[model samples]
Target chain A: MTEFQAGPLSLSFGRKQVLHEVRTEVLRGGTMTALLGPNGSGKSTFLRAVAGVIRANGPIMLDGMNLARMSVQEKARYCAYMPQLLPPPVRMSVVEVVLLSLRLGGNYVGASAAMERVDAVLASLGIMHLADAMMGELSGGQRQMIGLAQALVRSPKLLLLDEPLSALDPRYQFIVMDALKRETVLRNMVTLVVLHDPAVALRQVDSAMMLRTGRVIASGVVEDIVTPEIMAEAYGVRARIERGSDGAAMVSVEGVV
Target chain B: MKERSNTESVQRALLCRRLLIIALLLSGLIAAVLWNLVCGASHLPLDLLLKALFSGPDDHLEGSAGVILWQLRLPMVLMSAVTGLSLGLAGAEMQTVLDNPLASPFTLGLSAASAFGASLAIILGLYIPGLPSEWSIAGNAFLFSIGSAFLLEMVVRLRGASAETVILFGIAMVFAFQAMVSMLQFVASEDSLQDLVFWTMGSVTRADWTKLTLLSSVFSAVMIWSFRDSLPLTALRFGDDRAAGLGVDVRRVRLAALIRISLLAALAVAFSGTIGFVGLVAPHIARRLVGEDHRLYLPAAALSGGIILCLACLAARTLVPGEVLPVGIMTALVGVPFFLGIVLRREKTE
Candidate 1:
């Protein structure tokens, strides 16, 4: 499998440094890593840096290739990032959106092959039926699925998703996470997802990276890093982890610290 | 068996829709040309008009009908068609680039800048000495239009290019040049003022073979260029962030589109004066008929623009019989009401 490392990364907006010396690593393929942090903790900034949407100090290494030096088109080939808020929807079909994403990544499969790929991605996400629907009429959760379909169609080696489940209900969150896991494993891709719910992260992800105030607080096994003491420190809440009915770790916040 | 037939039926239906639109536009273009020829100040019947068109060169034509068709009507009809096609194509790209439905050369102040330039030529007699006096107005208008585009480019470079920024600057440019044009109007002699007013109102009477050849050649080049870049332009419709994520160089594509848009608008305005409404209205009509696919949108927009201008020319000539109202006035009279209806209908739906 591949290995991805982002080390000593620093980013600033004007004079205020948002991310400083943040370092994280994950299996470069066949895994989903949950990025855990409180709000305003530079989680989004760090993801943007890795996606090459913004400049950052230090190299983002994907299979030993430095992402900082890669052109936008080249980086797009290896990495795809879905932002938290999609742009206002245009009157385009779902399949057209996916096909556009493929075209943008310089993947020039002929029209029929491109449509085939769109169908495949939509089918994989169970959105095949909505392929002909207009994007403007879709609900937020459905749009999120379309966003994911767009990202997945590119077949990126590294997929960065920013708050992808924020708009989804319980059922879609699980479906989307399970699909991400399956696709990541199937394609040998490194799927880095930003998730706020630690309990959901515990159930869905193989590894976790926790950041607080522009720094990485912990990076390792989910159980070891998501302790009550660490939660209280990072999230400023007194919390405890307990086994749920499904035998997976769940975080329950007792009160504000 | 069922699925195959279903797919075939869908394909056939789509092909029919495309062909129908194409046929309608072709017929409309032909009808507009013939109507424009027959309905001028001196009405030539359909048969005489056909004979005039088919008759030998101007030197060998039998009578005044041939003389009128060859001399007065032919160039005017061609100019109306060319100006509409250019402005419509430019408007389609402008709306895509700015992400605003109402944007066009007229809205963006390029036309106003060209008017200001022409006013300087007509009112102040300020023109380059080397060129003939006849060409000074068109040449100056062309230069100032390019200047307006350059000003836009500067703004984009200074404050990172965005749709809102481009539109805001364009509106500002429009007001600035309008004020300048008004000031020129204030200072002009009565004769020159009338000339300036008529030029601003727009007319195709200035058309000649030389100007038509130049405008058509430029229009053809830009159309081919836009057609080639239709894919990237379609990507831009989703917005800058999405386009960039898809690996499009958003700044580069927008800048290129703006440059070509400036050239197209400049050439149309320089030759035919500041003809408004066709650029703004045609693209909206086209989008309604063909959806947002740029490949279809561009051609449909071009045809719609041509149809509107041709009809405007027809009305300008025949509305009062002998005295001709400016085509620009007729377009605004027709366009504003139609635009309001579109807006009101949209509001009701929403």
Candidate 2:
């Protein structure tokens, strides 16, 4: 029953505008949306702007609350942002890193309650065995999983993940997407994920937003948005969309436009 | 359910291990303090030393032992402990906020600026106008070191407080202040030059109750402030963007940490002169012992700092009987080898 909306967001780095009056369609809870674009198209910037990780000129409202006016801490109460980079290999244990998300922003939980939450998130992600392992000793893919666990542990209303599956192998990517979809539906949370592969987006997400040069090229259901013309305009690549036996759309990139 | 139980037990064991390490460090500090109390020029036997300590300073006991205990050994011992704790805590925070293991109070030009201030006071008799001549050296050192901290803060404000900017600017300040100290040294008279050099060598022999009380109070205040932000500080190790995403005000945290580091480090260097390596090496030792969860790491670093200085003080007293060497020289001599060992061991392990 929750709704998230951000619009007319504009941001610039010195002279170059990274996002220009960009807006997202009303993203409802209990569904995953893909943010797809080529390099320099402001996919990450738009996500960061919505999450309030950086300042942008516009309003962001979630469940009738104005997020743009909120402080970073206040925004964090409802939004969980997982950056594109994998968590660095520090000497902290995986559980310790995941537990850190609950330690701040005025939502202080007691020790046992926090530990229960961490365990639940790790178990859900199937990284339960890594709970006691040092983050420094984990592989890149495992660290990415840890990052996802950290994002989910807070149980925020809006989950913003920037390229969460980039470092993951194909199996892990599938597992992570499945976990994301399950968690989003179970928690009834609004999830926005930046993804590179339109094929993955066509197969996984319910809807997609395509951006080009900091503006939205198209936004609609995944089937309608992954058309060959939009793909060429957004990613400079010629593509074909074919329906599989299961009646799911799958994108096949032919070549560079 | 069994997996949950196992994980909980493993976490409990880690906590127990950390607590035990901290307990051991505390005990080591106590032993080092006692050893420092007894190892001076006229060694008071353990029983007599205990009796004198129990009788208190106000009670005029039997012998020169009481006089030495109250006047000479006690002030010096307490000063070393307090100063060591201050620098160690400051260094730990500095390293964390700056995100570089090499960062310390010394790396930030506080010691270099204090050396210049002490040199000016020693060679030129230049001091704060209202201060008594006897307090000139320490007061001037305090003023300049704190002033340098303010200058660094200004640079951070102007340049966005990135780790690289702060570290590079601090290095620039270090060289600038060292050059000024050398200029002062070039024109100093032979006697004044020797006195200035001795002051820079850093000894607690000049420790008095007034300086000790001021430094102890400051150290306690900074320690409380640091622990208050321990969770956010620990989050910072993950990186600024990640910490920010977790609702930490990274800029505010870094600024507050800088202020605390300045107060503790500036005061310690002012009172004790340029005591190096304790700030640089103590945190590394603490990290090796307790890992990087600042709650435990901070206290362990403080205790390790105190122990290192206490042992350095003991070496200063005993290295040449009846002739106390500069404790600063002892720290560098002791610290360099130990620091090298930690570095080499870490390299091998990695």
Q: Provide the TM-score of chain A alone for each candidate, in the order shown.
A: 0.96, 0.96
Q: Assess the local accuracy of residue B217 in candidate 1 as a C-alpha lDDT between 0 and 100.
A: 89
Question: What lDDT does the true structure give each of the candidates?
Answer: 0.81, 0.85
What would the per-residue lDDT of candidate 1 be over residues A29-64, giving only the tens digit for each residue?
898888899999999888888887777989888898
Top TM-score prediction, candidate number: 2
Query: Across residues B145-205, which tens digit of lDDT does each residue of candidate 2 receive?
Result: 7787778767755666765678778889889988888788789998888666665688888
Q: Score candidate 2 by TM-score against the native.
A: 0.91
DockQ for candidate 2, C-alpha atoms: 0.71
Question: Per-residue lDDT of A1-257 in model 2, one digit per residue for the tens?
Answer: 99988888999989998897998889999989999999889999999888777889999989999999998888888988888888878777887788778887578689888888889999988999899999888988889889889888898899999998998898888888999999999999999999988889989999999999999989989888889999988888889899899898778888998
